[model samples]
Target: MISLTPLKMLVLLFSCVLSGALGGYYAASFSPVPAQIAIVDVQALVKKAVEKNQAQTEDDAKALMTKVKSSTEELIQRGVVILDAQSVLTAPEEAYVNIE
Candidate 1:
């Protein structure tokens, strides 16, 4: 049998509202921005690399892999999310990037 006086009830309501406002502010402040996504045609990139470098020997393949890895890492460091072209069904033209 809890009996709340009007003043006590008002205080409780005020406390709840304050807590909710603070929580919302905290969440909004800490929320991450949506990442920009870029779709890459990995197969095309590989084909182009092979054609340019004549990737027949193991060393040539390794060099091609190194180049691809560096480029991907550079994009990631720039806060861009890279997705394989094949995995994406459809994307905006702006989402496609030429990594050549």
Candidate 2:
């Protein structure tokens, strides 16, 4: 028959704790490597996006201004108006249509 003395139990516990800590250290040392990261120039990417947006906005604004100018010129060519039945009757057909 075997009996465990307090001293033997303490030694066993200490050995278990020491071996567990050592095993954990070794496991961490051989852990899987991290995935590769793709490098990007964030400043350049932002600048390009901003420039593209500005160019698109400018193009849209120019087209709108051109359309507005042509419409205004057409209105001017039609003739000036004072509140009268003749002005209403003679107004351009385009003036009556609902523009999108």
Candidate 3:
């Protein structure tokens, strides 16, 4: 037969309360912060994203401009070759095929 005297009952009750309190404290400490209640700098995040996108867009535009210039130059050279093909063929043959 286990008889809990006044002193033992007090100690048992105190231990249970202490253990429960410690457990609650540990659980609270380990709990994740709710997303809706979390702190964040929305403006700073948006600004950073905008800056990154702007820089990427500028770099893309530069690459596109370089490509366009190169393509334009190639087209111009082709046009010149097409326009001068007849003159270029006659120019080299005049001296080589000349019969005296």
Candidates 1 and 2 compared: the better one by lDDT is 1
Q: Go through the candidates in order and give the clash count of each.
A: 0, 0, 0
- Alpha-carbon TM-score of each model against the true structure: 0.49, 0.39, 0.36
| Candidate 1 local lDDT, 2-97, one digit each (tens) | 999999999999999999999999999999865488888887877886777673787866876677667778778988888989999998887877
The residue ranges of model 3 lying beyond 4 angstroms of the native Cα positions read: 37-100
lDDT of 3 by residue, 1-100 (tens): 9999999999999999999999999999999853221112333433555676765566665654454445445444644221222233333332221111
- Global lDDT of each candidate: 0.82, 0.52, 0.50
Worst 10 residues of 1 by lDDT: 52-61
CA deviation > 4 Å runs, candidate 1: 1-35, 52-55
**Residue 66 miss distance in model 3 (angstroms):** 48
Find the number of clashing residue pairs for candidate 2.
0
Model 2 lDDT-worst window of ten: 34-43
In model 2, residue pairs whose N, Cα or C atoms come closer than 3 Å (at least 3 residues apart or on different chains), thus clashing, are none
After superposition on all CA atoms, what RMSD does each candidate show versus the true structure? 7.6, 28.0, 31.1
Error of 2 at 87 (Å): 69
